[model samples]
Target: MTEHTSIRIRVTGHVQGVGFRAWTQARAEELGLWGWVRNVADGSVEAWVSGPAGAVADLVEALGHGPAAARVAAVETGPADAASDAAGAGFRILR
Candidate 1:
């Protein structure tokens, strides 16, 4: 079954202030994902990605590379938080 699912990914390394969030937003939209990406105080980029299984997987793969300007060190993907609705609206950048 191709049901919707949410994946929360925490990207480590030099991922802040280097257009990571914008890149993630663009990639997520390209994959037709529905979620958001934000910068955490812990110096990591966090993303809430939700969509089809394939799309979510693709998003994770993209995060592994990020923008050409980004030097992605690591990307951790797993189930989203219980508070996050798997049936959210669309992909975006959180404040």
Candidate 2:
């Protein structure tokens, strides 16, 4: 069985008010990932993503460019303290 991993990602630049959260939700669900995406107070987009290692990596890579409306400046990733099931059943968009 594939090993599962969890990571926290913070995407900077032009990420707010650009459907970045909704776009991330779609991608995470498509990848069968469990996590939450939200717009940060600092004007960045943050996510706690958990899933198969490969899927997590793919999602991180995709976050680099983000939605067509987003102009991603940078993406920072690190180990997430939360468990894979922390987000529960599926991906979500947190307000």
Candidate 3:
């Protein structure tokens, strides 16, 4: 069977109001991953992603840089439970 992985990411810094959510969606789609990205009340961008382990890793790395308008400070990653598999079939920009 193919390898699968799931994780939660919290990106801090200049992520809000910078098209970060849309950029994340595009990147996840390009990587053929499924997940949801949203802005937290604390001005951080949080995401839960699930896909091939390598793809997820790539997404995480890309997240560190984010969009050109985003000055990413830190990317915090950790394991996420199956309940986080909420995007159903595609990547999404959550409100």
State the displacement of the C-alpha of residue 23, model 3, in Å, after optimal TM-score superposition. Answer: 0.1
Better of 2 and 3 by TM-score: 3
Of 1 and 3, the candidate ahead on TM-score is 3
Order the candidate numbers by TM-score, best to worst.
3, 2, 1
Model 3 stretches astray by more than 4 angstroms: 86-88
Cα lDDT listed for each candidate: 0.86, 0.91, 0.94
Between the candidate structures 1 and 2, which one is better when assessed by lDDT? 2
Candidate 1 residues 1-95, lDDT tens each? Answer: 88777879999988888899998988888888888889999999998888888889888988998887788899998888968765657778888
Q: Which candidate comes out best when scored by lDDT?
A: 3
User: What is the alpha-carbon lDDT of model 1 when measured against the actual structure?
Assistant: 0.86
Reference-based TM-score of each model: 0.90, 0.94, 0.94
lDDT tens digits, residue span 1-95, model 3:
76889999999999999999999999999999998999999999999999999999999999999999999999999989787785448998989
lDDT of 2 by residue, 1-95 (tens): 98889999999999999999999999999999988999989999999999999999999999999999999999999989754457447898888
Regions more than 4 Å wrong, model 1:
86-88
